[model samples]
Target: MRNNLHSRKINFVQDFLRIQNEAVIRRFEDMLRQEQLKLAEADLSYPMSLEELNTVIDQAEKDDRNGRLTNADDLKKEIDNWE
Candidate 1:
């Protein structure tokens, strides 16, 4: 019974270390990607402020609730008619 408990503790420690290593690797990969993007001169635009995003979302929800938004198929049909 004591041996079994010791084995379980070892297994738990191994699992913990594995997860920690994986997290560190993921962070390293992310840093590398960011560095590559910087080297490539990618335009890293800042996202809209929370208030601005909230306003956009609110407007979209309102339009959806009021049936002001067109369905994809319907919009396509309308465009076809125009053509």
Candidate 2:
């Protein structure tokens, strides 16, 4: 599923890059923004269960132990280089 999602993302970028119509580009941008807003709102609407909270904590602890963590400054620097 992850691979499929990644491939779909690449295809979407390819499709987006081929677009030349200004109106179509504006519509795509609006739709994408709306979908992202819906996703964010949905996340905030959910109250985490005790089990879910514990799972998140466990993942963080594992990440810490495995040294799979990024500090805020490093993350911000990385984000600045993103397209």
Candidate 3:
């Protein structure tokens, strides 16, 4: 399976390098960008691992102990004064 994938990637790079049309290259660039954006959005929706969740919770606990949080009433009042 690894060898098959390696050969496919090699062939794709060869084919991609032979392209002479500017518009076709731009289309491939656009498609690659769209796929990357979709992958990023998908990454955001997955649950974090236990260690990651714990790290976030730890940070929040430290922040709370240090009085880094604001209450809802203060937040609403601050937002109301925003330009």
TM accuracy, model 1: 0.44
Give the runs in model 2 whose Cα sits over 4 Å from its true position.
1-19, 80-83
**lDDT for every model?**
0.85, 0.98, 0.98
Error of 1 at 65 (Å): 0.8
**Global lDDT of model 1:** 0.85
Cα error of candidate 3 at position 6, Å: 1.3
Error of 2 at 73 (Å): 2.7
Better of 1 and 3 by TM-score: 3
Candidate 2, residues 17-69, lDDT tens digits: the string is 99999999999999999999999999999989999999999999999999999
Tens digit of per-residue lDDT, candidate 1, span 5-71: 9999899677656775777778867988999989666544666789988999999999999999999
**TM-score for each model:** 0.44, 0.63, 0.60
lDDT of 3 by residue, 44-65 (tens): 9997999999999999999999
Number of the top candidate by TM-score? 2
**Clashes (N, CA, C under 3 Å) per candidate:** 0, 0, 0
Candidate 2 whole-model C-alpha lDDT, 0 to 1: 0.98
N/CA/C clash count, model 1: 0
